[model samples]
Target chain A: MKRRNLLATAAMGLLLASGGAFAQGMDKVKACFVYVGPIGDGGWTFQHHQGALAVQEAYGDKVEIQWQENVPEGADAERVLTQMALGGCNIIFTTSFGYMDATNAIAAKFPDVKFEHATGYKREHPNVSTYNARFYEGRAVQGHIAGKMTKTNKIGYIASFPIPEVIMGINSYYLHAKKANPNVELSIVWAFTWFDPAKEADAAKALIDQGVDVIASHTDSTAPLAEAAKTNGAVIGFGQASDMAIPEYMPTPRVSSIIDNWAPYYVKRVGELMDGTYAQVDSWAGIKEGEVEIGMITDAVPEEVKAEAEAMRDAIAAGTYHPFTGPINKQDGSPWLAEGATAPDGDLLGMNFYVEGIVGDIPQ
Target chain B: MDFGGINPVILIATLMASAVPILLAALGETVVERAGVLNLGVEGMMVIGALGGFIVAVQTGSPVLGFIGGALAGAVLSLIFAALTQVFLANQVATGLALTLFGLGVSSLGGQGYNGIKPPPTEQLLPDALADLPVVGPIFFGHDWVVYFSIAMTAVLWWVLKATRVGLIIRAVGESHEAAHALGYKVNRIRLMCIAFGGAMAGMGGAYVSLARVPQWVDGITAGAGWIALAIVVFASWRPWRVLIGAYLFGGITVLQLNLQVAGSVIPVEYLSMAPYLITILVLVIMSAGRKANGAPAALGQNFHASR
Candidate 1:
């Protein structure tokens, strides 16, 4: 009878030990990434891939990273997400605005899986998070340089799409350019694609032929800079998603650039997942948080001009300056922001109208 | 609203450069179809050529050698399709599509480290004084050698298809492979040669985009240019000169619409972007309606069996 009592106690202890193991979760965290374009695009996807590499490097053997490139943003994205969840992925990052609906839908179906969508604003599920960089801050710096650098008093913009994010960038750039040189006339061309090198090059050529001496693009290739390089300093352009200075065309055509830094954010989120402290939240990091960065300003710009641009960058980083400070008006000439007033996040998030002096419809 | 800066001379010059890639690909497809094969892998071959040409150009610093490398890569790739469909007797349509999917994957894999690299510069073939002539100079003399090569290939193909005895054998084979086999002509051999030629031309077209026009490497750089070349072949009724005309028409519309956007014309941007595809469809409809009998080769998609 005493021996039977001891066996019963040992059985109870074994059951409790199994339960504790279940509560502690698996040994390694599986993280997956879905990219909208090939990592060789040399722009947007390439930067995101760098972030994924950082996550792997930070955790070594504790994390397993898997990614699939060139995943289209439609029904195909849903299939990919479902497969990732079934394949034991604990966290998934869908890196494009178009994947917002798919990310939210899949997150609801797999409540245990964590999702992060970039450059989007829908968060219907508790497991879904949204993150974006304040790219317009970098655009403001580009505008200041473009305004000072333009000899023709004309600046051309090659826009990708008619979304609020792109519209805001256009307004921020034009506003800062006009602030520096009131005579600067801005011309906008909507390319309607995020990554087509040939079309992007053609757009750059058309703008140059129109006598616009300064160019800026919202697209995701270095084609525009290459086109500008052909003119041998007659035309100047800024790099779009990364630093695109080919040594042969350096310091002249590609004067400055906007760089997307997503490594720290990825590492942090993965760390949270590993520590069992992961939560769904909206993360909109800017220059201050090291999300948006301005690339090297070449020596081609005058010393005073470069210094002025750097000062503006520092001020934005330190919270002393905002890109949307007003005394600004809408395209229809109505006051949008009063003097000394800054734009609210809500208004900036849904910005669809052009500011005063940008002479074109927003293409509804 | 300003059409003042839209110079006609420069417009035509840009159109000529843009048309060369499509013209070259379509012309090659014309020859392949005329030899009784429907290879839908033009896109696959073109992208492989783009990567191969860019790599060689960056490594060797010679655009000429780059074009040669691109052509050779495309031919080697097409040889795989030729063996599967010609020897193993696989379905041409399915094999062609599989080739395209395989090519896109392989090229993207090979293109990992080659992105953002520029090709060696290609200079204009004509001298400066001649190229700088007032109105005709920009239109006629300023383009690189590839543009002239496209035109030259069109003329040469036209003569080969209509005048040569070898052209007679290809036509005979395309019309009825069984009858050509009876005539002691090697049916599968001729078809293999045509497929290789088609692939080389498509590769050169892709090289033109990477080496001369946009002049950089990007994934899927030959974006849908191959499919458009296929459409041109159909609308041209497999005629080489007609293929040239169709390509130039498409190229002209593309150039004109972009210029209109910059000139600030009143048309909507979306509609202007759709203009080229819409017009191409309309032209195809009209051309098909005028020609009652089908222009496709009688034995186009059929597999051959010597024992049967």
Candidate 2:
């Protein structure tokens, strides 16, 4: 089979070299990835690269993936996109918020190319689409674990900006923790960036000094985990992206992680292209869709706590429960949603009000 | 009316701290410009410093040593600009831009391994009691030593530029490099030293963000702060005291807007996020309004050739 595939590839290569244009309807799937950070950064971009590698291994000659990491947020983003487009990338995935305007602009310029931007709202042309994993849903599980495991009743949340996305994660985590253990209190610190290991660590230290036991961060670094590990046996953290594990620096992140399964999506798109049904899509997948997965429960987690967390996870998957179901109150004790009124997707995405269990202002 | 809610005191403090990166870059540029040389490679020098300080601090476990490492890295990176502008007599602006592009790539590669790791803890200098004092506490006492030194450097710079004989020589060099060259001042040497110094300070400012403020190893961590600082120098009309005001104002806008977002105000966080940069641009536009707004040295961008 391998020999036959190689021969076919050789034939195709020869035909293409002769400029004969062999087969119709997507002869090759030219895919590109744009990273906000360096691929070797051992964080967010690393994980995305892992997914890209998985696709390359799976598809072989059928797929050609090219990636440019550390492309800045503005005009540079447009330049990289144009370069990728001119290089014959049929599908380009830009992975940053600052890349939103640039991606849209480039997508308009190259009408045939499919542009997918992660965590951006402005999706214009039929060629452009937006996709984001339900990271907040996973944060709920992390909060649940923190609530059950923390003896101090104080869980520290290191956030990246006060944007609705980060705010939503903070609220979801707090809501779940508050549900599991009523005494659980949240100590939040906004680090103001997607990646800054030092500030993330300092925020962790500052929270620990103030008597918080568990640490959670939305920033794209393992600084919180490393900081948590230094405290002998007390502190614990969950992996942010599935890529957070740096074995030499720290042990496994205790709670589960939210993994982005771009493979299935990528593969499906490639399949569509092969069948002449390729189209742009704005996809937001959660636990129900398997994009967000809960990993092995670490030994640091107590048995009872693990059982409760597993139950919650199961309920979420079964559609019998939601992390942000109602009867919740704002931090100021005002009723946010009446009983049984699950917070809608719109509210979740534009979350401005904090729930009852949190301390400190969202800060104007 | 609601200036109290805006927390002007905290705003001012943040602005001052924010100005450090710009002040460092500007001070170095001030010297270079004073010597009739324009080294526009501030951004490159800064990024090199960002990685250098981050790597050293992580390795040495000392923020002070990390800062020194940052300055050295800046100086090293500046030599590229120095070589191009001085020896090759390349177009200063174009060469500086190339330095930035090259620095971005080199620093990304140099900083690869250091990414996603937590920075070593920084030690605060002020005594706990003093650090806790009211409005003055955070503004005056709570900053790391670098903040104080930045302020002190501004004063020293003002004195050097206006009150000293050496200042006269530097000013003379900027005004007429040919004349300074005829008067036997080592034209290229002085400009080289000033360019290197500017690079070092810019690097130190970059280090402060990585080591003191944000203190993380992220790609493009300087995040256009170098450009903003460059603009601040012009906005301040090249005055040392005004540099402090400009830096603090920009910083204050950044911190206040973030604070407002956290406070759950009605304003969109996006606007707040962009407010500082937009304000800086606006300030620059306003500063350039009057005729004779070119407060800069007449020979700022001109190359000084010993033979010419």
| Best candidate (score: TM-score) | 1
Q: What is candidate 1's lDDT per residue for A270-350, written digit by digit as tens?
A: 888777667788999999998989999999999999999999999999999999998999999999999989999878878
Deviation from native of the Cα of residue B53 in model 2, angstroms: 2.4
Q: How far is candidate 1 from the true structure (C-alpha RMSD, Å)?
A: 5.7
Worst 10 residues of 2 chain A by lDDT: A15-24
TM-score of each: 0.93, 0.77
Interface root mean square deviation per prediction:
1.6, 6.3
lDDT of 2 by residue, B103-159 (tens): 878898798777666567565579878878888887788777888888898899889
Candidate 1's C-alpha runs over 4 A off are A1-26, B1-5
Q: What lDDT score goes with residue B165 in model 1? A: 97
lDDT by residue (tens digit), candidate 2, A229-328: 6676577787777645445334434455555556666666666765677666777778888777776676667788888888888888888988888898
Please compute and give the TM-score of the first chain of candidate 2 against the native first chain. Answer: 0.87
* DockQ by candidate, in order: 0.52, 0.10
* lDDT by residue (tens digit), candidate 1, B203-275: 8988888888788888877777889999999887888887888898888778777777777778888887788
